[model samples]
Target: MPQKRRYKSRRTNYRRKSNKNNRTTIILIAIVAVFVVSFFGYRRYVQYQSESKVEMVQQDHSQFIKKVSPYAVELGRQYGVLPSITIAQAILESDWGTSSLASQYNNYFGIKGEDPSNTKVLQTKEYTNGQWITINGRFRVYSDFRESMKDHTKLLVDGTTWNSQQYRQVIQSKNYIDAAVALQTDGYATDPGYTNKIIRVIQKYNLKKYDEGIK
Candidate 1:
């Protein structure tokens, strides 16, 4: 009888040890799972923050366009032109009015000439002999920003190359992208990606809202 009692006690001890081992293994597995999930969650959160910072920088760039957009709209209304297109073109040409030429000469559009009778001489950088050569080139200088806008409208309307039906249709579409693309296709600019850049600036700044008030 004593041997049997001893045997029964030993079996109970063994069972308790086995259950404790199983519990320990389960706890360890749960801990590992939680760690993995937290690691991935942290990684995703960091990625989101990085993306948000990039978007904020882009928004800051767009703010400049927004500041000067109302002037473009008013000019368009008076000249019977597309407001969004004018604003996008101005943003593209002037670099949000931060360019040296724009700041000094009020030349939002880089219209150049050499004849004294038809041009205004300004100190500007000209690409000559594969170098950025500074010279006093004849550029169309405006008295103010409003005059620049008016001259841009007049240039578009009177210039035979830009006065085509196709160009007019695209501008009148009231779509900023369409107008920008048309400008590039119609030889309005020499840059290959000029239209895409203009479209990006317009869209990023939400400049299309100016078209809404058009009758």
Candidate 2:
């Protein structure tokens, strides 16, 4: 009877120890799982914040055309030009007014000049010998965006003495499409698809109503 009692006590002790170890292991496993879930959840929260900021910035840029269009329409009307084409050209040439030249000096149209006081030397692209080449050139600078818009409109209507012929067809065009084509045909830009780019900008912004005098 004494031996039987000792054996039973030993067996009970062993089972009790095993149960305690198993409970400790389960607790540790639960702690690790909670930690892993928390870490990933925080990472996802940070990623969402970053993405939201970028989306807001992009939305601001997309609204640039709407913000600057009133000035474009006014300048276009003053010069007897189509506002839609003028605004589209501004959007494409200036990259919605985010280009280095446009941002720095308000030179949105990339007009070249020799004036010492209002000129900036920059590398520009030129098509030569069936290929495009980069060359250092002087571009006109403006004090403000308004000045740049006025000058750009005037340039299209009344070009320089040496290049007035280039804008003759453009100034004479009665519609936006014809104006875009005339600008392209007269080498307004080096891009082969400059006319298409202008048209695309106009369509994307729904700018044709300006040509129809719609508010």
lDDT winner:
2
Model 1 alpha-carbon miss at residue 154, Å: 1.6
User: Poorest 10 consecutive residues of model 1 by lDDT?
Assistant: 160-169
Q: Candidate 2's error at 136, in angstroms?
A: 1.1
Instruction: Point out where model 1 deviates above 4 Å.
Output: 1-67, 113-137, 160-170
Error of 1 at 192 (Å): 0.6
State the displacement of the C-alpha of residue 95, model 1, in Å, after optimal TM-score superposition: 1.4
- State the C-alpha lDDT per candidate: 0.74, 0.83
lDDT of 2 by residue, 1-215 (tens): 99999999999999999999999999999999999999999899999999999998678666876766788888766777788877787777788788888899998788888988989999988877779999999999999988878887888878776887668888788888888999988878878878888888788768887776622
TM-scores of the models, in the order given:
0.58, 0.75
**Residue-by-residue lDDT tens digits, candidate 1, 107-213:** 78776655676567767654445566676767777668767777777666555443545356444555666677778777666667778888886677677788776
Question: Residue 138 of model 2: what lDDT?
Answer: 94
